[model samples]
Target chain A: MRIVAALLRRDLAQMFGSGQRGATLLPVLFFIAVAMLYPFAVGPNPELLARTGGGVIWVAALLAAILPLDRLLARDIERGYFDQLYLRGIAEEVVVAVRLLAHWLSFGPPLMLATLPAAALLGLDSETLRTVELGLLAGTPGLAAIGLIIAALTIGMRGGAALAGLLLIPLAVPLLVFGAGALATGGSGGIALTAAISLLLVAITPFAGGAAIRAAREG
Target chain B: MEPARITATDLACRRGDRLLFRGLSFDLNGGEALQIVGPNGTGKSSLLRILAGLLQPFAGKVERNGEVALLDERLPLDSDLPLGQAFAFWNRIDGAGYRAEELRPLGLERLADVPVRYLSTGQRKRAAVLQSNARRAGVWLLDEPLNGLDVEAAAQFQARVGGYIADGGIAVIASHQPFDVQGLTKLHLGDYAP
Candidate 1:
């Protein structure tokens, strides 16, 4: 239990603490930038902005998740952190799971907070903003899980970071569809589906990512 | 601590459809050390990885009775963190208390305040040795442990290995450089090449 706590603390410090302030802040800034730009791209008509704004937020959140993927597992693997951890009788799955939680903790809540300013910029009503918030809450964990899996799978390849970004887009479609669909459908059903996908992805990430890392060691 | 040993029988290694070595076998016991020496591309590093359980042997099997520690080309410390803080992170996970004396042999006691990125190659290698030592695991698998050390540091490292073996630890080193240790068995890996 202490080992897990230590791993989580170290991971959190690496991702969101003073050492990586840029990493923690970049996604939130990018999220707001996207919200700020959508109005200009589609023209400043409030009705259209409100109607499409929730989906735009979902897209921006997904892209923001990708920005950190390159830094996730690559540096650890290259520096032999995984091997050292494995030597201590700690399984790879345990490390991957800890990393998943830390990754979500770093980006998910901040992106959620940034949504307030984003909502105002797009002129979204309180009801629509609520749906967007709920959708992101349900969907971001799944996005983090997918990012971890892709990062582990691409650990040793050249141009792996760019490839990981491309790979994440296809796998994340389910979460994006259900999350953004909540606004247009005006129901809790899409949010529930998004949460369900998030649960599945979160459960699968540890085992799949663990296997990918072990395979990478052989290469 | 329980007695620890590593036994390998007729191990074979294949890399990219090419067989690097075959018909290799050795047994290492506590209070003992073995140095593997060979030219480049002769599977010295591969043998260490195999013994470390990070690589699969093409044939045969390896059996071990204790936790393994490896010192390789990569430094596991966080580059952005000061050496002390980075070591503290591992110390928490490893349940180890930092000993200032461990840093003395490598002349690293004063560099703990420096970030890992600022350390020179030999300094980084010394830090890696200290990191592995912190684990106090029974089996130590070191690849090229003497690559970048000065003569004095190299002597210090050799002395440390000797002390570790005296304390009932197992050390298996892979290096092309000559290593001097009392009662240390030297294995020429090229002899096992297919």
Candidate 2:
């Protein structure tokens, strides 16, 4: 429990300490505002707005997730923190899990918060708004987990952004599917599937990210 | 009782398709210090990581006594943390703890609240060494422990390291700089090839 706290604190400190919080927050706000405005530019048609809201939210979240991957392991790799992590006798899985959780706390919550205003702007029904929030809570962890893996894989690459996005978007397909599906259906079954997928992502992310980090450190 | 330590037998390593070293064998006993000296690009850091169990040798085995602490050259500090907070982070990992007030007099306390990224190279190196010592392990593998230290800091480092040895701890330091490291056996890695 202490270790987990320590990890969480470290992640939060990194995000705020380095002023990365502002960078992350700005994009989310911009994305939400821009997405909301799309309906205004076209028309205030409820059917069109409702049909597009889920995909826009998911896409915005995906873009936000990608924005931070370049910063994740890159700095640590350059400063030799990754090697320090390995030598500290902490299991790689624990380290990866802690980092992923921190990413979610920093990047995931603000995304959900921003989604609320966008949902309202798009004139989403209460049911649709609830679905959007629930789907986000359920699916963001998987996005973070996969983002972390790609970050580790491309720690030292020259053109990391293009590569990380290419590698991660494919893996995030299931997350996008389940998340958008839940928001679109506005039913308990959709919520259940989203929850299961989120749980699976939370469970499996550590192993995948841990293995990648270990391998990268070894080289 | 003293814990059994590792014996490296015919250890070999390669970096980027080139062999760094090969046919190397040695034993690290408790309370012993070995200095690995070599020219640039000779893989001294690589050798230290292998000993610390972070890197596996291409063709050798390293049997560890128990837990090992490695002070990597890159001093992995949390740039977002105040210096003190970064030091405190060591506690999260097993075998990493320290007497907070005792370290205050070392001038580290003044900079405790400063983020690690703002520290000078020598200061960062000092913190890295101190943090590694905090781990309280039987064996410490330090890669270029004295790289950026000034004369006074070097003396302080030697004293601390000597005290660690007196307490039955072991250290292996890799450096190109000379220091008065008494009773430290030299392992000239330049003589070996990958």
Candidate 3:
């Protein structure tokens, strides 16, 4: 338990603490920027913007999650943190789980918060904004989980960054479909299904991510 | 705190399609030190990893008793954080009380505020040694432990390894450079190459 806490603390510090990667706060900025760009790309059609804004937010959030993938676990594996931790008898499953949590904490809430300005940018009505925020709250955990699993699987390979990003979009389709679908239908059911998919991903990420790491170690 | 033993029998390691080393075997109990010596690519590092249980040996089995600590090329400390802060992370995981007496001897007291990435090679190597010593494991597996050390640091490392084995610990080192540990037992990895 103490090891878990230590691992979690270090992970949180690394993801959100300071220095180049942490201080960039890139995901949230990218989220807001993506939101900001779509309106201009489609011209100031408030009606059209409002209609597509929620889906745009979901796509933006998904893409933003991808931005942090390269730094997520590759460098740590390359640096031999995993082997050291394995010596300490901390399970990779636990480490990956904590990492998933840390990854979400690093960007999930910030992306949701950034959405407020984004919602305003796209002229989303208050009700739609509420739905979009809730959708993100439920969906980002799944996004972070997928990002971590892919990060672990792609570490050390040539052009891994490209493969990781490409891998994420397809794996994240469930979250995207249900999360953005909630906006289209404006239904609680969509949100619940999104939450359900998020739970499944959360449950499996530790094992899947752990196995990928162990496999990477062997190869 | 107890007698520690790590034994490997007929270990074979294959990287990709080629076999690196085959039919390698060794045993180390408490108070013994084994140094793996070979030229580059003869699998000194792989043997260390195999002993440390970080790699899957293509063949053979290993049995270990007591905790293991490995100090390889990688410095587990966070590179972006100040040295004090980085060590603090490990200290916390290690149940917080780092023996200041052990650390001061390494001559790193003045580097507490430096970011780990900014540390020179010798400094990083010294930090790895300090961290491993802090672990107080029964078995220690080190790869290229002397690569970046200055003469003084190398002497300090010899002292540390000597003290560890004197305290009934086990040390397995993989390096081509001559390591001057007391009662050293050497394994030339090339002997097992296929």
Candidate 4:
């Protein structure tokens, strides 16, 4: 627990202290604006908007979650900070967990906040909006976790960003499908399925991240 | 006061199908300092990485009794952080206690808030050394630690190293230049084929 707190504190300090607050906020805001504008430009057709809203929101949120992951372990490995963390008596799993949590915090909340305005713009029913919001709240952490795995695997490579997306997008397919499906269907069963899938994602991320870090350290 | 803090037996490492070093054996006892010297491309850095546990050797094993601080040419500092913040990070993570006053003589105090990427090579190296020393780990594995320091800073670093040894700590330094410190044993890698 103390190790987790230390890792969280260090990562949070780096995120907020390094002038990256804008980087975190601006992209979400831009995506929200673009999402909201889509309805007006495309004629505010309720059926079309409802059908597309789920996919659009999920894609935007996924992209937003992934934007910073490219630099997650690569930056640290290049600078030797990762080596220092390993030597600090902290286990690799804990390091992955803390980083995943930090990434979720930085990238997730703003995405949720930005979604509200777009939700209104899409004329989404209250139930659907709530479903979208809930799905995002539960799902972004999974995205961040999977992103950490891809980040670690590609840390030493050129074109890491592209590789990370290629590696992670396939894994994220289930989450995207469930999240958008839940929002579009507006049924309790859909929401439940989304929640269940989100839970599974949360469970699996730590293992993936752990394996990647270990491979990185050894290789 | 304690036994050897780090031990390696018949350690061997290979990089990209090339054998860097093999059958290397050493024990770093407390209060002793050993220097690893060799020509360029002789796997000095690779040996340090293996001892630091950052890289696993293809053969043999290494055991460390306490925390080992490894320093290389790579500063590993965040480019976004100022010099002081970088030091503060080391203090925060490793519980290294450093004072701004102590760093002033090295001309680092003034650059406390300047991002490390903007600093000159010498300044960056000095800051890395200062941060590593500030940790005061039980075992120090330094690779080319003297690369970018001025003469004065180098002497001060030697003094600090001496003080650290006097306090019953151990250090293994890998460098190309000859170190003039007394009571130091040399481990020459030139005789070992890569």
Candidate 5:
């Protein structure tokens, strides 16, 4: 437990540390940027904006999560942090799990907060805003999970970050379907299912990421 | 820490289609220092990884009874952080602190405020050595541990490994250059090449 605490502390510090400040905010700004641009791209039709704005917000959140993958596993793996942790009796899964939490903490809450202005930007009503926020709360974890899995898998490959973003879209489609679909359905069932998928992804990511780390060591 | 033992039986390593080494075995006990000497691309590093349990052997098994620490080509320190902060990061995880005297021997105290990326090759190597020492693991797997050390730091590193082994820790070094340490066993990896 002490080891995990130390791991969590290290992971959190690394995720939000000084040098990564720009990268950390890149995702948030990217979310808002996407929100801001949607209006310009489709022209100023308030009805069309409000109708599709919730789904647009969901899309922005997913893309923002991908922004951090460039440094995620590759930096640590390249720096030999995972090897040292493994030697210290800290399993790769623990590192991946803690990283998942840190990634969510750094990316999720802020993106959720950004949605406030994003909702207003797209002129979403209070009810639609609430649904978007709740759906994001349930969906972003799944996004973070898939992001991490792809990050681990793509480690050491040339042009991996770009490839990971492409890889993530297909995998994240389900989360998008369930979470963003909730906004359209106006039902709690969609939110519940999104959370379920989020839970499943979270559970599987540790094992999958752990194996990827070990395999990456060999490659 | 409890006494440590690292043993491998008929261990084989293959990188891609080509086999690196095979039919190798050894027993490393506490207070033992084994130096693996070989030409480049001969899998000296791979053997160390196999022993460290970082890589799976192509056709063998290894039994380990204690914690391991590795100091390879990579420093493992956060490059953007100052030297002190980088070491502090590992110290937090290792649950041990680097004493002032320990830093002096490695000549790291004076460079504490320098970002690791700014340090020269030799300085980064020394900081990596210092951090691995901080791990205080029972077994040490060092790949080319003396790669970039200057004359002074090289001698100091030799002395430190001396102390590490004297304290019942096991040290395995993989380097083409001779390591200056007492009672060192030279394991030439070329003998085991397939």
Candidate 6:
């Protein structure tokens, strides 16, 4: 348990620390940037913005999630941190789980807070803002999981970072459909489904990412 | 320390379509050391990885009786943090306390405050050696353990490894360079090349 705690500390530090401030902050900045630009791109009209803002936030969050995927697992594998952990009898699943939690903590809640300004930028009222928050709360864990899996799968390839970003969009459709769909319906059903999908993705990340890490060793 | 043993039987390794080596086997008991010597790409590192159980052999098996510590080309230290903090992180995970005295032999006692990325190649290698020694595992699988060490640092490494062997530790060192340690035998990886 202590070992995992140490790993979590390292992961969190790497994500939120000084060295990776750009990677850590890029998602939030990009999320807000998207919200800020939507009014200009589509021509600002309050009703339309209110109706469309939630989906835009969802899309922004999804794209923002992609920003950190490249750094999530590549550096550790390159530097042999995984090999050292394995030598110490730590399973890849355990390390992946820690990374998932850390990755979520780094981006999820920060994006939620950034949504406040983003909602205002999009002229979304309190009700829509609440739904967006709830949807993101439930959906970003799944996004983080998908990011981890993709990062591990692409660890050794040439131009892997670019490839990982391309890979994440298709895998994340389920989260986007359910999360943003909640805004259109103004109900709990879509949010519930989003949470359910998030739970499933989170549950499978460690195993899938672990398998990917093991396979990458063969390279 | 408990008695430790590693035995590789009829081992064959394949990297991509190339067969690196085949029909290679060795056994090392506690207090024993083996140097895997070969030119580049003869499977010296591959054989060490197979013995460490990090890589599966294409043919045959490895039976290990103790936890293995591998010191490969990669340093595994965080480049951003001070060397001491990076080592402390691993020390905490390994459930071992930090002892400054251990860094003296590697001449790392004064460089602990320097960031890992700022350290020179020799300094980085010394820090890696220190980290591996701190693990205190019964079995040590070292790949190119002396790659960038100065003469004094290299001698210190050999002395420390010799001390570890004297205390019933098993070490499998893969290096083309000469390594002086007690009860050490040489395995020519070229002989096993397919």
Top lDDT prediction, candidate number: 1
Mark the regions of model 3 whose C-alpha exceeds 4 Å error after superposition. Answer: A21-24
Query: Considering TM-score, which of the candidate structures 1 and 2 is the better prediction for this target?
Result: 1
lDDT of 4 by residue, A126-209 (tens): 777788888887677777777877887786778989888778878888778877777656666655666677667667666776
Q: What is the C-alpha lDDT of each candidate?
A: 0.92, 0.77, 0.88, 0.77, 0.89, 0.90
Better of 3 and 4 by TM-score: 3
What is candidate 4's CA lDDT for residue A47?
88
Candidate 1 local lDDT, B75-152, one digit each (tens):
999999999999988889888746687677678889989999999999999999988768788888989999888898
Query: Mind giving the per-residue lDDT tens digits that candidate 2 earns over A31-67?
Result: 6877767887879888988788778878878877887
- Decreasing lDDT order of the candidates: 1, 6, 5, 3, 2, 4
Candidate 4 chain A lDDT trough over 10 residues, lowest sum: A18-27
Please say which candidate is ahead in lDDT: 3 or 5. 5
Superposed Cα deviation of residue A161, candidate 5 (Å): 0.8
Alpha-carbon error at B180 in model 1, in Å? Answer: 0.5
The global Cα lDDT (0 to 1) of model 3 is: 0.88
Off by over 4 Å in 4: A1-3, B1-4, B101-107
Q: Chain B, model 1, TM-score against the native?
A: 0.96
User: What lDDT score goes with residue A195 in model 2?
Assistant: 72
lDDT of 5 by residue, A64-155 (tens): 88899888789889888898888877899999999999989989999999999999999999999999999999999999999999999998
Question: How far is B174's C-alpha from truth in model 1 (Å)?
Answer: 0.6
Classify candidate 4 by CAPRI docking class.
medium
Q: Record all residue pairs in model 6 with backbone atoms less than 3 Å apart, i.e. clashing.
A: none
Model 4 achieves a DockQ score of: 0.61
Alpha-carbon RMSD, each predicted model: 1.0, 2.4, 1.4, 2.3, 1.4, 1.0
> Second chain only: TM-score per model?
0.96, 0.90, 0.95, 0.90, 0.96, 0.96
